[model samples]
Target: MPALVYLLVLMVIPLGLVIAYAFLTSGRFGGVQGPATLDNITRLFQPLYLEVLASSVVNAGLATFIAFLIGFPAALAITRLSLSWQTVALIAVVMPFWTNFLIRTYAWILLLNREGILSDGLALIGLGPIEVLYTREAVILGLTYAYIPLMVLPIYASLQRLDSMLLEAACNLGAGPWRRFRTILLPLTMPGIITGCLFVFIPSLGNFVIPELLGGGNSQMIGNLIRDQFLKSRDWPFGSALSLLVLALLVIIVMLQASAARRSRKWGA
Candidate 1:
């Protein structure tokens, strides 16, 4: 009951305000007005909103893939370590996540800019300085770095929970390393992979700080567009509609993943 109170008072109620604002009409002075209509939702279908959505999807997809590529191998290695060392390694992996996200993104900006550490390193290596900050790729890099811990933690947790005997049995049956990983290990750990992907992808899709700092306007994402509509452009209705649409898309993705997981589990059984 106490938790419920805190959740409602702190989270649900505030979210309800956003929901109400999203469905209502625009006010004369940029606030939301009642007597709502479908116009806000209709405006979300405009090419501008669609483009932002698409950019967000692509950028988030790229980031999620990169995070997976990095985190999975790391998770595998963590699981392979001595049990006593696994705890230390896991703590090290997650330590970066305790820092502020904005500061983390800014650190990347310092490293990737033309006058940044990367350029200095390049010059020392006799390679010409390269521009990096404030681009789509930079945004992807920032997001991937920011969320790697989140992805790895879940995957590592899942991998640690797995039965080692099953893997041993597969190895005894003449399964090569690649074959065992593909047929046995990958299947068992897919839930963690999916969970990690969702954790990275959903937030990346709606992320404002990384894109705003590292991507600039050139790589505007859905979250930026939504912010612009409400705060910059003062289009409350449109912003609300955009928010709802993003939430809807997230819900759909979760549902699809859930269904796929259920099917996979059934088949595995």
Candidate 2:
């Protein structure tokens, strides 16, 4: 009962307010005022804002894919290690979280900037300076770096729970490594993969700081637009509408994750 009340007070109430604000008119100052209308919802369909949404999806998708490519191997490698070394490997995977996120992001800026370490190294190797900072690629890289650990943890948990005897059985039955992975391992670990992808994708879709600092504000995602609407433009109604869109997307993703998890359990059974 206490937890239910806590959720109502902290989550439900704020969400209800945001939904209400989305339909209302924006005040000349900053807050909502006047009769409710659908202008804010319609405004989101404009080509300019649609483009931002599209770019956010594409960038987030790319980051999720890249993180998976890196994280799956890392997770698998950790499972292969001895028990003591596995703990150390897991610690290394998550060590970045001990530092401030903003500081970590700033470190990337130092490395990717024109006169930074990357360019300096290129110069010594006789290669021309390649522009990386403030680009779409840089934003994607930053997203992948920041959230790859999220991908790794969930996958590692799934892998840890997996039965090694199943793989041994497959091997004894004459299945090769690739065949065992494709038939036994991949299917079993899919729930983790889905969870990991969603973890990376959702945050990447809404990330603003990485794009603002790393992409030099040239590449703006939906989160940046929402931030501008609330802070810079002071369009609370429109910002609330945009927030609703993101909330809706999150709900859908979560529903899909839940559905997949159920199916995975049934399949295991």
Candidate 3:
């Protein structure tokens, strides 16, 4: 009853309002009315919205994949270290996240811009100075940098809890290093991989802050478009519809991830 009351007070009521609005045509004056029609849903399939959705998926997927690649190895390396070193490494991974998200993204702007530290440093090394900020590549890098620790946390936790004996046993049973990783470590750590992927993907897919600050108009993402519709354009109905699309996409991703976890569990067993 307590939990139910909290849900009613918080999530349920807010979601109900959103659902109610999504079905209506948003007035030009920024109001919603309900003689429910498929207008909003149909409009969602327009090429612009479709392109935004596709871009969100691609960018989020790239961030998730790259974070996993960096995290999995880092997680393993931390586990194989001395206790003091492991603690230090874990703290290092977490420290970046403890800073403000906006500040972190802004820091990336300084690092990746043509006149910024990184590009200029590369130029000093005789490499051509690259204009990187406000580009798609920079957006992806921003996302991957911001979220890598999220991927690392779950994976490192899982790796820490894993039995080292299984690895040794696999190696002794004539399994090569690659085979051991494939047969034992990867399967055991899949729950964390799934967890980390969901963590990075959901936020990246719906993110507005980093994209808006870093992407400029040329790299406009769905999140930025949604923000523009709601706040700048004051088209609540269209924004609500787009918001619903994001919610639906999140639900689908969660369901697919849950299904993947189940399959991995079965395969592991």
| Candidate with the greatest TM-score versus the true structure | 2
- The collision pairs in model 2 are 134-215
lDDT of 3 by residue, 1-269 (tens): 99999999899998888878878877777778767877877889999899999998899899889999998999899998999999999999999878999998898888888899888898999894988888888888888888898899899888887889999999999999999999999989988889998889889988888787788676777899889888888777778788899999899878988998888778543
Q: What is the RMSD, in Å, between candidate 1 and the native fold over all Cα?
A: 2.0
Cα lDDT tens digits, model 1, 61-81, are 999999999999999999999
TM-score of each: 0.92, 0.96, 0.94
Winner by TM-score between candidate 3 and candidate 2 = 2
Look at candidate 3 and give me any clashing residue pairs. none
lDDT of each: 0.88, 0.94, 0.87
Which structure among the candidates has the greatest lDDT? 2
lDDT of 2: 0.94
Ranking by lDDT: 2, 1, 3
